[model samples]
Target: MTSAKSSENKQAFINGWKQSKLVRVFLYFILMLVFFLSSYQHLIVSDKNMGENTSEKEINQETPIYSEYSINSLDFLEHIFDKLEQINLDATFTYEEKTEIYKLYFLEEYNKFVEDNIKTMQQSEDSLDAAFIQEIENQLIDQQYDFPVEAFFKLPRLSQAEIIKMSAVAESIVKNLMKEQIKEADIMRGKVAEMVNASNLSDDDSRVLVTEIARFSIFPNYFYDAAATKEALSSTKTTETNYLQVVGLILLVILFVVFLYMYIKQSNLQIRNNNVQLLMLVFIFIINMMGMKIVALGHSLDYPYLGFLAPVALGSMLIAILLDYKLAFISSILFSIFASIIFNFENQMFLFDYRYGIVASVICFTSIFAVHKASQRSSILKAGILITIAACTSITAIFLITNENVISNYIFSLTFALMNGLLTAVFVIGILPFFEAAFGILSPVKLVELSNPNHPLLRKLLTETPGTYHHSVMVANLSEAAAESIGANGLLCRVGSFYHDVGKTKRPNYFIENQVNSENPHDTIDPDLSKSIIISHARDGVEMLKEYKMPKAICDIAEQHHGTTLLKYFYFKAKKQQELTGELEEEVKESDFRYPGPKAQFKEAAIVGLCDCVEAAVRSLSNPKMDQINTMVDKIIKDRLEDQQLNECDLTLKEIDTIAKSLKETLLGIFHSRIEYPELPSRDKKGVTKDEATVSI
Candidate 1:
């Protein structure tokens, strides 16, 4: 039997998983893929140099080729060579010709280098500038110098023989003067060459430049060309932007497919009755979407971690109220990963910051526990307050690492903290009713409504059959105490007990306790017929509850309140009747005289069963005292305990003891007395009875 039961369970699990539509499962897979891929894309694009080198290569391939050199460097060299040639011209001439020679050569060299290098030069080309330097050298050598007496004696000029002599005269004053100028010019050339070498370099090697630009931009002393630096600076940004849009599209598709899967899966549930759960899933998806959008917006605005608040608040509340704690905790983890993507993406202040996740997790835990015990809408607000506090602490810890700009970060963190609380409260308020009404979930409010004495059926029971109404109230009280003491849901137990005897309303006069002024209907009837009437109530109540479209929880209570216990009283009474009537003995069975039930499988239902018996048995005692009530309560509990009626329930013996204590207290208070003050009658001054007597206190 155990093996068979295990096999049945395995099949049930397999069937549940198999029956889930293929399209929905496929969509889930797609969503997971997209989520991972988009997250990876975000990481790649954040590097700023993602495809820069490749882009540069593509550009280089399309552009025309040329010999690479800083023509300006070559031109400067040519000027120095021309100066050497002019100095040689005056060295062999008279002092009067020296100035004239120097002026002419200087003018010629300046114009030539300007035309060849500065005027026509482009910044980058195919090859190194080796040939350009050679051309400049050849140009300098091509310049002819005339020897003159005046140029030779000139202070700035030298004779051609002197220039040739100075070429070998490395220690000469003129050579030294020329060498210093050349050295200074060479230094400038080297600096410019360095900049040019870095110009079309790989983006991965551009970090030092970026850092320099960013650091120097903070002060006015740095001279960076706004136009020249613009293209390089914006290239990384453009690539990042393109990647983000692509990733966003992918993520959007993922979210849609996930939403569709959730919607369709909910739709396929035979128990869903309508698209209510589907609508709820859609709403949760929308909430998640809203959260993602907010995060994206926050990142765009350069404010990171701000978007983490909405999902944490909303997701926690959803898991707590709409689902179980375990599922809620799992979703919290998933949302935490999503939050990292949303809040701490490319523009994030911190990498892998645990603050958002920690805050969200705390909120999730608090929400689950808080709302689990929540009996009203106001209780969610309390839970929201707790979430807000946790969120604040989490965000503040995040801000501690980001304290470089304390004021702005502090304000940003606080904004999300406040939002977490507000959104949680709002989501709980909005989703509660839809779930309660559509799913027919037995919330505390529903229990309270059904427990009202003014309910139509309860009122009918009160008027037409006061004894049954009184009996139901007692049962409700006992069941509530029992359920509470056993860590079961007391309100549910109490409300179920109230409606358990509703079938007794149908034939009030036939039931012994309800037949106050009526003749005993069972007296003339055979014992078998009487047993049928007494035992039919359980079946009738179930049918009545079903007709009203009551929730399964309530219907279960109706069906299971009277398990499959034998009707010993009625069955024995029937046996005696059969013997007295001299009827032919028909086969009588114990099962035939029992309630057709799957039995109470939970503590609440079991408690209702005990309450049903205890109420009927206790109410029959006339003017019972505290000791008598205690004994009766104990006896009823003990009888059920001994009979193992509570076997199916998960209640412990300790819990049962607590239930007995709570019941005893409640019953004593209920049966407490009200004392009346007596007044003495006074006659007016005469022994004879007066027309009117005065009452004295």
Candidate 2:
């Protein structure tokens, strides 16, 4: 007994938790927190460069020193030799004169180099030894006349052996000069310093000359400082300071809260009232965040815009189709913001990437508009194509405006943008069913699918109770028209009308519509028994719909179409029979003949109920004229209003009037009068009535 009580208590607790709105709200809050944490992980933590860490591998493996020196040295040598060649071949001066002029020019350049280096070194904070400076000054003086001017001047007129010997001597003089300068000026550091000090460069004057030339090249001063480089690399690893990260996180939380508050305000609690919508919104948001994470993983790739291909429109399309345009629009904006953050992982300076954000937002916004009214699967593909064009166009325009990359890079970005659209379509198609089933959302596409005549319940209704099927078709027309007139869910009303009378197939002959051949099953049965059969159809339809796993709204329409209204025909028959039997002592109760109903709880269900009565009453007329149709529609609406059938729904009086007018117009169009034809000759060669004659004109 104790185990049984405990089991019962556990079941009760589970039921209570399931129905608790506070628990659901808390669950949504937890989901939002998960999204926040995931976003932070992908955008900041995963980048491996957004936090402080002193220990790091040095980035001086390819420190650009050798390449910088080699290129500059080659350029300097080429410039000096070209000048010398120009002076040597001059016809206006002798060898001695050219030699003197070249020496003067070389001395002038040397003086300028000394002056520049002295000034730069004095201004810089690098600790220079006073002895080194004095040595540098002494070397500059010694190297002023160190060049072998006479040998170099005679090089054009000397023999090959003499020229080679003279070249060697000149090279020795330049090498001594360069080595003196390099040693005094601290030109090499780190590994280069050790290598130069230990190496025997007596025969390799070329290396010394290049190093000296590179020292005087017009490149920015760079020195190898192992400690400083390590520090800079460690700093680079952190994108933002701890204070800034905390501030950004707070701002993100505030922005998300504001967006949710605005969403609730704009929707007027519709989302909060419907747990399914709230859950779906959270589901789409999480999916979008996951897409962002997937895209952020491609940051290591060369293309910076690769994150733009995250299929931002996937969530927007699902929201627009499964929810409504308003929520989809808001969701697109939020998704674009998240896209910007995800794309900004590499660029640590900016918190958001407006370029990718604007493009993504535009594509998502355009896609929502493109698929807002999508009722078929093909429309989803068409929306994808349209959004692809929009995305490509937007990307091209941004690239053209920014001129940030070459044409090929722009082309690559455009290709990614196009792929974004195609991926969105694929994902929407694949995941839409899961969302619809999980949330129990009867999307327009699903409604259109359910409205197909080949559906099992619809087919059975057509085969067994053809009259009810025809009546349902007429009622669907009326409901669709009325729903459109009031700006309600016309497709939902139409689809619900088709399945409303599905239970009539079980006992077709008992209903008046399927009782063909002028037979009435109610005539042979007691009025109480007939009323039971009549009211049982509504409950039976609800049960059958539940078995088929139809949407709750459709099931509600089937159950509440009669809406607890008294079955007056059966009730009046019961009273008349009771009077004939003279059993006046027994009281007649209206509740006994009424349907078991919770009343229509939404606009679509209420409109379907109104249209159902209007269609049946209009069909019963011998010939429904314009006046009769209008009168019948108004009467049925008035009776429903008086019976308080529409009290539970959100329909206003003006909308109700609009529904009546629309139904009357639709019925008039369906039952319009035919034009009269003149008399025609029959096959018997005798004058026959126009109705009976079959003329082959």
Choose the strongest candidate by TM-score. Answer: 2
All candidates: TM-score: 0.53, 0.67
What local lDDT score does residue 222 receive in model 1, on the 0 to 100 scale?
Answer: 12
Best-performing candidate as measured by lDDT: 2
Instruction: Give the lowest summed-lDDT range of ten residues in model 2.
Output: 64-73
Tell me the lDDT of model 1 at 530.
75
Give residue 179's lDDT in candidate 1 (0 to 100): 20
Q: Compared with the true structure, what per-residue lDDT tens digits does model 1 show for residues 198-315? A: 3333332232222222111111111112222334345656566656756765776566455544544454232222233334444554566456555566553545356655646575
Off by over 4 Å in 2: 1-241, 267-269, 301-303, 404-412, 583-586, 673-697
- The root-mean-square deviation over C-alpha atoms between each candidate and the true structure, in angstroms, is 18.5, 13.5
Tens-place lDDT digits, model 2, residues 573-660 = 8999998999999777888888888789788899999888888888898977888888888898899999999998889998998888
